[model samples]
Target: MNPLTVLRDSLYFFQRNLSQIVTLCLPLVIVEAILQRIVDDAVGPDASAGFGLIVGLLVYPLYTAALILFLDARSRGESPRNRELLAQAVNLWPRFALLSAISTLLIVLGLSMFFIPGIFLTVVLAFSEYRLVLRGEAPLAAMKSSFNLSRGHFWRIFVCILAVLGPLMLLKEFSYSLFSKDDNTLLSLVLDSANSFLQLFVSVVLFRLFMLISDKSDQ
Candidate 1:
């Protein structure tokens, strides 16, 4: 599974399913961005970043779990309704949110140690969400399985993630420079929502990798 092939396939899937994805996930993404803006305004510039992470924890798992379910449905040649996906996602939210929190904490801790360990943890723990959401593994168990599953495949997964996020990071900076949030609240909101929505592509790529690796490992 070359990174390029994985990216190409993922992009194709993302493009083909763009409308469905937008319909299924964009509203919650926008809500998250709006809540973030509210928190920023409420706390002012000196607020701890953890407040923003709290906003994310409130909404991120809902749409993320829904998207993962949508991806799985499409893979199996099924077309599930948005409400159905959202309902199922709601049910998964408690565990998924806890899983997200733990994963974020571990990544952040690893990042505090010279940065490289965090990157390594990021690659290795990539599939934990899928294991939890799709395979019904508990949070810690899923993380353990993902660590074991990612062995010898670190570079492949890391490269794909970098390729997808690198350009996004640059574009986000550029957009912020061009349209200062203080000057244009509406535009800033649009930019924030768009950026978060596009980041879903990374999810698509990782889901693709997860499926491929799991299938191979099963053989």
Candidate 2:
């Protein structure tokens, strides 16, 4: 799997389907951003990190799950109904939420050990959500399968992930620098929406990687 090609194709898909993507996921993204802002205001930064995780677990999975289903439908050349996709995602919410929570906890635990281990864990566990959503595995099983699936493809997956996420992270930092925490709420919402929208491309690239590696492994 060529990471660059995956990156290129993911971006192409993102651009080509920007309208559909936005139509399906943008509300959830904006809602998430708003909820996050509320949490920050309520608890301040010094509050337990778990509060942030809790909020993420509440909002992130809904949109991400929808996007994954949406991407799958598009790849198969089916014109998906946004409402139908959202309904399916809502139905799948509990399991996906569990997967998200597990993934976050593991990443946090790894980070607590050391920064490098956290990155390593992030790379290794990256495919867990795909396994859960795409393959219909239970949450824990999906995580285990992701560990197994990612075993030999660590660098490849890492490269794809970094390629997709690096620029998004940089944009996030730059956006934050442009506005203080107390900056105009509307501007912050717009930037946050943009960042969240672009972050979906990371899932697209990984979906490509998962398909590639899954095919290769099957052979």
Candidate 3:
């Protein structure tokens, strides 16, 4: 798959469905605002606020999957009512929570061995939600499948994620650096909310590309 093509299509999709996408992401924005506040409060000059940052990172994939599943339904001309899609997505919460816990443990263990294994496990598990929602697999099974599918494609996915997410992240950092003097707390929270929305858009785009590639390979 061509990266440029994927990026273009993803941008087009995001532009066309902006309103619907924003609607789907509203709840996540609220949650992220709360989380950002917690993180700001927890982190300090000398101490590392490790666990909270980790939790904050993991929240992205779970919610991204939920939002993408809803978008996918709408793209297929199915009923994509917020309530129905959210109910279906929420059903996977327990599974997401379990997978997050297991992945976190493995990552921590991997870090003990060295940093490479931890990074490897992270990229491998990156697409777990896509597998869960698209293939209708159980959570652990989805995690395993994502690991397998991502083996040769890990770097590709990593690059794709960065390509889509890096600029937005940089912008957030820049904004926080510039205007956060008066009250960095509120500014930081707003940045988090915007980042969450951008992430959802990127996730849906990447998930759609993955599904397209999977289908082509199957045929």
Best by lDDT, which number?
1
**TM-score of every model versus the real structure:** 0.99, 0.95, 0.81
Cand. 2 TM to true fold: 0.95
lDDT of 3 by residue, 55-165 (tens): 555465446656767667766877577776667767777666666677777877887787889878767887777777778778789888888777667777777777877
Q: Which residue pairs does candidate 2 place in steric collision?
A: none
Candidates in order have lDDT scores of: 0.96, 0.86, 0.70
2 or 3: which has the higher lDDT? 2
What's the candidate order when arranged by decreasing lDDT?
Answer: 1, 2, 3
Segments in model 3 whose C-alpha atoms lie over 4 Å from true places: 38-62, 104-115, 181-184
The 10-residue segment with the lowest total lDDT in model 2: 180-189
Tell me, what's the RMSD of every candidate? 0.7, 1.3, 3.1
* Candidate 2 residue-wise lDDT, 80-174, digit = tens: 89999889889889999998888888888888996778889898888888888889999999888898999888998888888768888997898
